[model samples]
Target: MKNEPVRSEAVGISEEILRKWEAKGVSRRDFIKFCTTMTATLALPLTFAPKIAAALEDKRLPVIWVEYQSCSGDSEAFLRANQPTAAEIILDIISLEYAEVVMAAAGHQAEKSKWDAMEKYKGKYLLIVEGSIPTGEGGVYCTVGGESAVESAKKLIKNAAATITVGTCASYGGLPAAAPNPTTAVGVRDLVPGATIVNLPGCPVNADNLTATLVHFLTFGKLPAVDAIGRPKFAYGKRIHDNCERRAHFDAGQYAESFDDAGHRQGHCLYKLGCKGPEAFHNCPTIRYNEGLSWPVMAGHGCIGCASPGFWDTMSPFYRRLPQVPGFGVEATADKIGLGLVGATAAAFAVHGVASAFRKGDAMESDKVKVEE
Candidate 1:
């Protein structure tokens, strides 16, 4: 995407040289566009705007991506990120050296190229891993070229500036690590315990999450602060149901019973229809998908919460809400159990009011007789 204005960071060149070659200074329009969007995504203060602009002007960072036992769907989702701008956006800003899926190199040549890049820019490139590492059967389950997946990971991670685990596969072991775990699938953290890992926990995470993370790393010169699961707080912090468009309908008790129901046409809440946005975390609603085309909830569907740890085991059925969540024992479905209590309390109050009226009537008669006496 470079056009003499934005130079690639693959050459191991210093910032001073790149700064001079930078023909196109970040435009006022483009800089503000990114600042505004990033402010909303990260909820940063207005004061950080100047810092973000400075970060953009800084030399682009280099990245190397690896795939393990995954479907490559997360990369596909990132490929759809059509934001910031054609020249100064997230992907455009970073120098991507090696990614098996999109890399133009092939066969033995491809493997050689990746190694060369790693060695050339050791400790300077971000390592992004998609999919899970298989530990079963001597790691024979997944072999690239002649090396095992785990072995390759060990080699690359030692010198990586930072690591980003993309998708549920790389973050939580995905379906491959499910019960029985025939493949003995493990996330990047499981294999490389020493590295600071960032987990984007989704079956196919939103592209904006990926971009935001890269931006954060670029701006801060280190990975952003993450939660217990190693996910950056900005993207994976809030629940989808919080900012959902149909959240109003949810509060009002309006629901869509089924796909064929009238509520579907009326655009009622899909909470009852198995929308898992309430518990699921991510910026899907706000970022949407496919350049603001549509997200799962907007299309009249529910989230499966593929991002949650042990999601394959705990968040099963994908459609039904959790009956009992992790660390929450005896938890009932919020709607059914809560409404039931409220309804019973209202009924009991109504019966007590009737009894009180009868008692008051008899007391009034007794008082009149006493006065006559």
Candidate 2:
């Protein structure tokens, strides 16, 4: 009789993790699929799937999640992660040493847990911050356990293996740091100069990105490559417009003039209605949200450019169209340029199509001659 493979257990994965996976209805095949999905999400080749799986099974990173001045929407999103589920990530994949939002401890006990984790993990744990740090009035605006936000962050970040700032609030001061900033809110990068911070900026960052970042670090022992502004290139390499569903409409010079217009009903481009897809750099259109269901534009709403720096000020007023398309002359409007380019683009495609057909015919004739010979 042939022996069946028992891979997960034989590979040194803890029985506890396997139990948790079983309880969560995640089979070994499901786990492998998850690893493959993560490999692809990180823009890594499928061959890296086994490496990612090994890392996840072997390394349980110690994580300390902190929050300061802003809504807890990012934490909420983190909790609702469906790919691995928050329970599996926190309990099985990572040793979440301290998280004020989810940990059972509270008050001084909570503070003690944080301090203890900091001391125990010391220079080894990952620090994940959710909101911006308030710098006004001696950082009195946001305090945790009698320590100001700045003071706590400074101490915590000093010895961290890496710091990940989730949400636009934590990445670029977000809404709190917008115009006439009262609390003088600033992001982790602003608070800690000379520190390498991985930024995942979104109104409420997609949990999958955060998970992928963690997995990348675990798999490779270093953070993924970042763009000029420190966002992972794999996730923010291209503008949303590059892969937007309405790109054809935009290229064809079709756009929605208002919220309830015929163009919108027919799924036309939202650029004229103030879509910032052309300027915003993110994987929202590809990775999507709510379990790969739909994104804002897909839901009939224009992109508000939440992923870009200081989008609240730069991309507003949200409903007003940009004067000119990016990478184009200032005098020419987007629709005008689109109209002019549409004709040229169509002509070029027609020419290319004809040439391709001719090439195919020539190839067929050559193949027939070779077969006869």
Q: Write the per-residue lDDT of candidate 1 for residues 1-373, one digit (tens) a residue.
A: 2333432232223355344334456443434555556656776775665565567564668889899899999888777666654235534478888888777899999999889989999999999999999999999999999899989988888889889999998987988998889999999888888697898878797777787778778778888777656777777666666778897786566878787799888888875565656566677888787767798888888777678777676555555432221222123233323223223322433554423423534324532211100
**Alpha-carbon lDDT of model 1:** 0.70
Clashes per prediction?
A: 1, 0
lDDT of 2 by residue, 41-77 (tens): 8998877776777687746899999999879999999
Clashing pairs in 1: 201-307
Per-candidate TM-scores read 0.77, 0.82
Q: In candidate 2, list every pair of residues with a backbone clash.
A: none
Which segments of model 1 are wrong by more than 4 Å?
1-28, 85-92, 324-373
Residue 175 Cα positional deviation in candidate 2, in Å, after optimal superposition: 0.4
Deviation from native of the Cα of residue 92 in model 2, angstroms: 1.1
How far out, in Å, is residue 255 in model 1?
A: 1.6
Measured by TM-score, the strongest candidate is: 2
